[model samples]
Target: MSMSGEDDGPADSGLAPEGVTNDLVELLFFAYRDFVGDPDRMLAEYGFGRAHHRVLHFVYHYPGLTIAELLDILRITKQSLNRVLKDLIEQGHIVQKTGRSDRRQRLLYCSETGATLTAELTRVQVRRVARAIADPVADEPKGARDEHGFAAAQGFLMAMIEPEERAAVRSLMARRARSRR
Candidate 1:
């Protein structure tokens, strides 16, 4: 059957609503694929996968993050987390220590090697992002246009997030930044 909107009535069409461009949906998919491509290849060399990359990224950023906090942030089951955590710890990419205040709690941190790998992966992605943003079509010469473009891009991405989760997302980012200082 032809899926074209021209052949189907509005109610029968599977297209997005007015003002929503289907091109944006496809662009996001392709953008994300390329964005993760470099890291995915590197992780394979270590016999790891995306899960390992995520764990390393989070622990590297949020040093001393509790097992519970990681669990919550990842939204994964304890059992699922245990497998990846065990592999990371065994490979010396991560270390777990007992919390000073709560002896039963395990706090996560990246080892020196983990930090190096994470930084390398992040550098690759950051370079790609910098190039994209610095492109003439994406960003204008220093001025109000540049600032406005940044704001518009930021606003667009933020709006893509679920409304209820936006505050929590912002809080986590701010907290991580403050912790680094």
Candidate 2:
């Protein structure tokens, strides 16, 4: 509802109706926290953290991704990355190959063990997602229409993000989609 004392014109154009934004923000936070919960537990069992899970997930998706690419995708400092990479490499979960084009460059690949673990993590996540979508108790409509609506909302959210950020996000999503096939 518009404020009675205020002349609401372009001032409110960029803002979501008062309570809506807060409610959506809260929902997003809780949803993401729950989304990561299972994986965090699994990672903890393997002596890994979210950072390690992220590195493993991407390397498993894009085998032979360069360190520079991983750094860009992660947006973390080299020191932090190095610590995680060292642990992963020592655990025999990932292998670093000398770049063919640049011998000084290190390219990361998930080892067979890493691939297996990654697959397990992904399976767990997908199963959880499928269950959430399929649950009748959730009051969500059952079928393709519901899935399509979810996809549409995802696209809308992506569109609201900055273009350059979108490009990286799209690349990552496309890579994952292709890998799943």
Candidate 3:
């Protein structure tokens, strides 16, 4: 809102001046709220939080993720991550191995216990996503679906990232995808 009591967006900014973006912004917030609600509760039972879930999910997906790379991917300070990393390591949910070529590098991997927990958390979320994407109703979003009704959700998420980081994210995901195959 401007000082003139109007809700117009900034001058010279090509954004919707009539505040049309607020609806999507609010929806994103609400969607995220419900999306993480279950996981948040599950983590709390283990005395954990979103930080643990994020680290667990990434390390599970990207085995051999280094401390520095995880830091960059999470955009978190070492001090913040240290607490979570230490807890995860101490709980036997994650393990750090010396990088094969670079002995000084600490590569992260999830333990079997961590994998089980991650699977449970992911199962809950995947069910929610599947329900939302299954074209269940007449008013459901269809454009988000690609040909054969898949893959484009990933594209939409990739498009939402910062332009400069998109390439790096793509590279990271590509490496993970290859490993899975």
Task: Specify the highest-TM-score model's number.
Answer: 2
Each prediction's TM-score against the native? Answer: 0.66, 0.66, 0.66
Tens digit of lDDT per residue, candidate 3, span 107-161?
9999999999998998988776666555232222456423432234343333333
lDDT of each candidate versus the true structure: 0.71, 0.70, 0.72
Native-to-model Cα distance after best TM-score fit, residue 58 in candidate 1, in Å: 0.4
Tens-digit lDDT track for model 1 on 1-181? Answer: 4455464333445543322233234335555766777899999999999888889989999999998899999999999999999999998989999999999999999999999999998888777676555542321134463322343454444444434554665565556557657
- Which digits, one per residue and each the tens of the lDDT, describe model 2 over residues 1-181? 5454654332355433433333335434544665677789999999899999999999999998998899999999989999999999999999999999999989899989999998888887776566545532221234363422443444334433333454565565556547656
Residue 86 CA error for candidate 3 (Å)?
0.3
Misplaced by over 4 Å in model 1 are 1-20, 136-181
TM-score result, candidate 3:
0.66
After superposing all C-alphas onto the true structure, candidate 1 shows an RMSD in angstroms of 14.6
Worst 10 residues of 1 by lDDT: 15-24
Give each model's clash number: 0, 0, 0
